[model samples]
Target: MSAGVELDHVTVRFGEFTAVDNATLDIKGGEFFSFLGPSGCGKTTILRTVSGFLDPSEGMVKIGGQNMTGIGPNKRPTALIFQNLALFPLMTVAENITYGLRVRGVDKTARTKKANELLDLIALPGQGDKLMSELSGGQKQRVAIARALAVQPKVLLLDEPLSALDLKLRQHMRSELRSIQRMVGITFIYITHDQGEALTMSDRIAVMSDGVIQQVADGKAVYDDPATSFVASFVGENNPFVGIITRADSSYAVVDTLFGTLRGRNPKGLKVGDKAILFVRPESAKLGTGAADTTFSSKVKSVAFEGNMTHVFLEGVGKKDVTITVGRHSSADIPAQDEIASVTYDVDLGLVLPEGKMARE
Candidate 1:
């Protein structure tokens, strides 16, 4: 059975450098979880700790409520598929898949049966006799997974398994991986730098930056309700507004933006004198009639329409640019530059954030 993973105040240090700062996280049993961050942000370090590949400098790593303080990678009930699919080139598919059993002294018949079972499970039935180099890129990836599954570990640790594939193949593999996890009912802890991959596959995602976790939530929540400026900027495209809180209330707020006064919903718990930033997704802004309660203005500076959607750039009371997305139906013959326009959005769509990493950067 797959097991849940927990890190209680985990920290990893490399001499003077703290590769992974103090972090605490929990992974539910049989859930597909991902650690998502850019390179050098210490996602790999956290994955290593969970797999028992690296000992934590502080705190405990627990799986299924059991502490794994001194266990080695192989000793834990976990299987790690490294970024490089380290399959033995000389071994045939069956041989490579069953190599772990051979080491444990399983007879040839049992090994072959196990290999065939896993080959079918990975959707590559009856291909065990083929050479490792004979498969396509995606097929080779499945073969690597089959080899790992042959061990029947309780948890699977994948380190950017799809990073090496082309874009189409990578997209294909995301669905494939999620399906396999469901079929096997195994917990998957994936580590990747690609936000798209993590958003697509994970049940919950932890966004990390500079060894610290920024936010952990479902894909849509992380994208729509980011907790920090770094998360808002990193998870998806956002137009940022930096302004001091002017008129404030629990239900709404008005900010004196460079373009004009932005009146929108306020995320409660802000004092009158506090400085705030509002983040709006490109899809949230729209070209429409002005309203006293809306957050945008009517003046549009630029408009471009891709085949799929229309991208409108608005220059109003804000120092930075504001962008909005419209459906092709809504894109029909938008007004030209210096023409009268009305840009608006629901007050609830606006967010209030402190000046954060993204603001400083």
Candidate 2:
């Protein structure tokens, strides 16, 4: 059965270095929750804390409403799947899957039955006798998951298990993992730096940065309505225009940017004279001046066609070059390099946020 996890005011410190800073989160039972951030953002530390591999310096860790302060990883009702997998090379697939059961003194017949059942569960039926060295990378990944599931853990922690796979295999395993999680009905706490992996697999994602939880929301909300400049810049590609707020209201604000006066949704409710940045997605900005609240013309620096979509880089709009994505159907209308192109975006689509630290590429 699945169990909920709770971290109340959790903080972890190694000597003087604080890795996780007072993070509070409630993860639902049987939910696929992901911790997403760049490297060294303390996501792995938080995962270790929940799995009882590391204790929090302050606050409480609870699983299924039971306090886990003094519990060890082996005692907790959880299992961890490391990035390296750590499978035994000499063992058969069946032996590797039932290693945990064998260590617990389970009889040979019972262990064999369990291993065969798990092989079927992971879609490797009748292949249990094959050596670990004989399986493909993707097949080995499934066997690793099967081994973790052998002990019937209520919560499974994955530390970038698919990072070593190729792009095609990684994408394929994303769906496979989600399907397996649903079938088992266990809480999955996944740690990953890849935005695509988290967004595609998670029911909810917690965006972390600099040992802080920046925002916790679903993938769509995190992508469309970011709570901070760090999240807006980190979660996806965006064109940021630095400016000062000239006018403000409840829903919208006008900013005096280098390009010109532009309007966008004022999500942070910044007042007039406040320093701000207007962020617009490349896809939201169209190559035209008609029917858009914000419009500007700039010289096209370059254009690259990637089959289905075209990327047009515009210069002289701001300190950084602005990117616009043109669809394949509209690629014929794309302006040549050195030619001027009019860029426009609707007020509802753009977001005006307080100026703060932006994510480094």
Candidate 1 Cα errors over 4 Å, as ranges:
263-268, 297-302, 314-321, 331-333, 337-342, 359-361
Which whole-number lDDT from 0 to 100 does residue 123 have in model 1? 81
* Model 1 Cα lDDT, one tens digit per residue, 1-361: 8999998999899998887888998999999999988888999999899988899999899998899999998789888888988889999999989987887789999999999899988888999999989988898899889888888888999999999899999999999999999999999999998889999999999999888888889999888788877888788778777778787878666766654667655654565667777777788777775575464555677888799898777774446557778887775467687666666676678776665776222
Error of 1 at 208 (Å): 0.9
33: Cα error in model 1, Å: 0.6
Which one is best on lDDT? 2
TM-score of each: 0.91, 0.96
Best by TM-score: 2
In terms of lDDT, the poorest run of 10 residues in model 1 is: 352-361
Model 2, 203-305: lDDT tens digits are 9999999889999999999999999889999998899888999999989998898888889999889999999999999988889885445997789999999
- TM-score of candidate 2 relative to the true fold: 0.96
Candidate 2 — worst ten consecutive residues by lDDT sum? 289-298
Show model 2 residue runs off by greater than 4 Å: 291-293, 316-319
- For residue 243, model 2's alpha carbon misses the true position, in angstroms, by 1.6
